[model samples]
Target chain A: MKKLTTPLKVEDLKDLKAGDNVTITGYIYTARDAAHKRLVELLEEGKELPIDLEGAIIYYVGPTPAREGEPIGSAGPTTSYRMDSYTPQLLDQGLLGMIGKGKRSQEVKDKIVEKGAVYFAAIGGAAALIKKAIKSAEIVAYEDLGAEAIRKIYVEDFPVTVVNDAHGNDLYQSGRKEYLQWLKEN
Target chain B: MRQIDAGLITESVKKMVMEANYFLPEDVYSTIKEAQDKEEWQLASDILDKILQNADIAKNDQVPMCQDTGMAVVFVEMGQEVSIVNGYIEDAINQGIREGYEEGYLRKSVVGDPLNRVNTKDNTPGIIHYSIVPGDKLKITVAPKGFGSENMSRLKMLKPAEGLEGVKDFVLETVELAGPNPCPPIVVGVGIGGTMEKAAFLAKKSLMRSFDSYNENPFYADLEKELLEKINELGIGPQGFGGKTTALRVFIEYYPTHIAGLPVAVNIQCHAARHKEVVL
Candidate 1:
């Protein structure tokens, strides 16, 4: 239940360990498969990204529609593995964190260790709960992509678990392997 | 013949869509909560805690349960005695889905072409299955199916001699192949009998059943119990962290198949398992 309330800067990520549980507050950017493609292209061409990448956390989500009187609709994390191809590129640019579910590629893990970056997984399919932490949201870019459009979201104490760390440790595999071994023995 | 109003049907369907996306269904919520209480593995328990937290966040904030809100899948049961008053039943249902996705602020996930990959903005042209049964009411079950579990679904056709043992082996192997990728503590819907497609349909449709409810047929009920025990034996656990509850429940739906074939389909559902039922 470690709470992180302040707006995190890129340098602040140096303090986060691989297994530490964190609650991220302040402005984070939303990008899914499509947005990631565009962002990576921009980086390849040596062009500036739409937002400052340094110390920023990226959440992989598309979200359902919002009903009346709601700030955002069912907003939950998508699988992070889908974006593994583009993640290292972003990480190279000082991108400090990522939020989603499931495993990552070896290349991305290497980048996380090479750079002082962290990866966190918000609960999948808990969009409504995640939305409460979002104080405000605005489409930052790629409006034509419909739900896949890039948006910047502001939040207070958005919760996540560090699935991968700067040291290249992964919780998902370790957790699964331990259980499988235990099952074989018992 | 009894005539059903298209407008009224659209309205109810629209609400169902919104409800399915907005509120996490009670049975699913309770099951996850129950898993948290019963999970033996620490990692599994921790994953369950995160899922519960996700549920809380979605309910309190009106956010979606997952990012891949899923392509719109609707099962429509039309009474044999009924006819639509205004438009075709499929059109009306698609209209309701469009309205629901738009008004509810949910994701529009349908694509017009698979290879070319063009987005169908409204999430329209839903995957609608229509079946005519006894009475006059039209029933719709909306499932916001995420791709993670959907990707893991499998169907196999076996020689009639293969029997239940073959079915059991295939079902277990399917889950084993899926591993933690589909997100564990999966709800496995096993559909046996009928043609290849029907078995697959029954498998997907079986997922609509309540998590804890037993199948109506006694033999099938027993089968559900046995399969559930074996699935848990896999130790895939919560989110594949490994635990006693590899699967929360096993639901079986079967019909008489051709004597020559034993068709079986296993539709996997992650813990999120968002689905809703409505009658219009």
Candidate 2:
């Protein structure tokens, strides 16, 4: 397993390969469908974004409200493809990585390669376990969006697997292929 | 005739909703444990372990097992000999969901309007299905459905000539296309031999059944086993990492259909399969 800290740089992602397990620490921002739409709209309107894009890793999630004394409720990655339309634009703004589940569109994969960004997959539906890694979470923007609101969260040892790396390798493709090959041989 | 209090229904539903969200049903939890034990792929096995751990945490901490506590889908079997007093059945059920979501700290995932996309905020107005059964008792099952798997569900109307092979093909295709999106190891719900909507409903209701149970019909039971094997053969594994356990079970629910059409619906349920019921 590889260990990474957020505010990630291109150099930090250069050596990563598809299928490598990763545990990320430091701070990451949360944004889902509605928040991504708003972020891209602000970029198009030439307004300053509420959060910095440079070296930032966006976690696609919409957590349940935190119970009293809890930092956040069950927090897990949402499906990534819904945000595909706005992802390239975010990458253009120097977004370094995305943490979500499921496969990304080819266009998003191409942009990840072009922009030296990475894509990571958190185990979907493993929310309760994943929430233990989050040390603190506070809504940073669009509170009206409720759970879809953008939150900046501090995490320690947040487990993820490298799905798409800067070199354009995709684990979803290669991993499935390898498994099928094993099935054939066995 | 027995008169049931609407308030009582509301209270029961409220508790059921919270329990459904916070607890992973035993059949699903055990099947996942079994899958983890059998999974040979290192990555797939680890992912399954995390899923099991998440369920344990959710149960112990009394938090939702998944962040998408889901749009509440309630199934009601009301006895024809019983009448609800004090309030309308629908209103009482909605009230129960609203209170449960608030009290449980479950995410309210419903929208007031699909196009306008405004949060309902209370998770009220659950999609309710009602049937009149024989006795004077009322039964309610609350199955909160997360959209990650819901989005991957599909329905198709096939020509009668296409037959059973066509149904099998479509089920495989839907799971293959869904890939990792629905969060395997998924429970495959197949609804066949109904109208378009009925097929869809059967597929969904099938998900409420326990993973270890099979369709009563021996033919369909064998078909369920066949489909489950084929799906795992696709190597979607747990979270699509690829392995022997892409699907924990396949359920088929069928009804008599018109002579001209065979409608099939595939409802995929993620490993966080949750449903709770109460009888009154």
The candidate that wins on TM-score is 2
- Give the CA lDDT, 0 to 100, for residue B69 in model 1: 66
Q: Each candidate: what lDDT?
A: 0.79, 0.93
Candidate 2 stretches with Cα past 4 Å from truth are none
TM-score of the A chain in model 1: 0.88
> To one decimal, what is the Cα RMSD in angstroms of model 1 from the true structure?
3.4
Interface RMSD, one decimal, each candidate: 2.8, 0.7
- Residue-by-residue lDDT tens digits, candidate 1, B1-280: 8889898878877888777765777888888788789776776788777677777766665656665667778988988888899887788888988898887777888889888667888888788888888998888888878787888889999988999899999999999877666776688998999999999999998999997798999999999999998988777666555577778889999999886899999999888777888776
Best by lDDT: 2
Report per-candidate TM-score of chain A alone.
0.88, 0.98
True-vs-predicted CA distance for residue B242, candidate 1, Å: 4.2
TM-score of each prediction: 0.86, 0.99
